[model samples]
Target: MKRFDEIDEHNYSSDLIDEMFKLITPEAQAKTHYRMGLAAKIDDALKAKGWKNQDLAKALNIKSSSLVSKWLSGTHNFTVDTLVLIQMALGIQLLDVGEEDKPNATSPDNGNTPNAPVELAKNIDAIKQSLTSVANSNQKSFATINYK
Candidate 1:
């Protein structure tokens, strides 16, 4: 059988898939991005610690490396407890709750207020940090990045 790449471009078109992707809700897209971002963070942490899927599986106390593979594939529906376990094992924060130095305040909206757009920008920055921390792993120290 011919490989997919060997097929003539004229024989197929990506319009259907493209349109389907376009139909996806922004919320769904954001969820996918965050899931993939978390996966990348875990993969980077494993590499930095000179570990493999088996090592992580052992650390996580799972019998199957395939489970780790699924997590790395960015499709795992990770639970908060599982995330905490992974964070503990890897010594990295998979989710950024807020600024460490800042005091916590109880918002009336529980943070989803009239200033939600501003808060969203900050949340995006936190996501960026998780996604890019591996690139800066070699640095001795770095300043905290604030998105204003």
Candidate 2:
């Protein structure tokens, strides 16, 4: 149970640090997943308590329905303070990001696995190409439309 701060930085290998960075840098995405799981738990609790979104919003002191809507939609990038508020409001812990639940928990695919990094890179490149194609198409569509 070594804390991140307790890690021996002087002895740290670049490869090890890079792997750690890959795991830690995706925290926003991990938090999004955790929030979604928490939301599902809260929805279940609300159903049991016969409470609605407005009720939870009122408890949280959030005025707008849109605020709650954004939270439920998982599109909002919540700050640490806001996450604490939501935890208090919902009475459930939402900090677990399912890192242990990864399919390749023993060895990550980012050059840590035998052939997984190659496959991962190929998949990522394909996704990037698809996204770029979609973006280019959208840009062309926008350019052709004259908004005078």
Candidate 3:
């Protein structure tokens, strides 16, 4: 067995250990986890659409296959713009926010039907945000959406 000093030369024999080391920073760990989550979502979407990396890149107007390869590698730190573009182009949601991220729903996927109040409030909030965005884009004045 190699001594601890030998292993301390910034090298590790185990791939798992190496990966763990890469996640030593809290920020890096969170970012890596998020990246992997998005990567898994992208992988599922590709499989569902029967698309190769080239197909998605072409659809997203991304000319570089290498960039797509990096995205699929589960290590790419995607920008919000890139994520938004991908979601808009593919029509597949990769990130869940607000009520969408909440587990409570009124159906098999949504919140429980018995608990309508919570779900209703969430739906209203989502609609309000949509309306606000639409109204703003149309140069119409509207009340800002408040969490309350």
Instruction: Give the top-scoring candidate (lDDT).
Output: 1
lDDT of 1 by residue, 96-129 (tens): 5766444323223433442234556678889899
lDDT score at residue 11, model 1, on the 0-100 scale: 70
The parts of candidate 1 lying over 4 Å away from their true place are: 1-13, 100-148
In candidate 3, how many Å is residue 67 off? 1.0
> Model 1 residue 80 lDDT?
91
In model 2, the worst 10-residue window by lDDT is: 102-111
* Superposition error at 64 for model 2 (Å): 1.4
Sorted on TM-score, highest at the top, how do the candidates line up? 1, 3, 2
Better of 2 and 3 by lDDT: 3
RMSD of each: 17.6, 18.5, 15.8
- Look at candidate 1 and tell me the lDDT of residue 84: 95
Instruction: Give lDDT tens digits, candidate 2, residues 1-148.
Output: 5788998978866788687767853445445645565566667666777878888789888787667777776566678787787677767655545654444322334235432444556778999999999999999999999888
**lDDT (tens digit, per residue) of candidate 3 on 1-148:** 8877668665457889878887576456545655776887787888888988898899988888788889988899788889888787667887565655465322333444423334456778899999999878766333444445
Best by TM-score: 1
Model 3: runs farther than 4 Å from truth? Answer: 1-23, 104-148
Q: Model 1 residue 116 lDDT?
A: 33
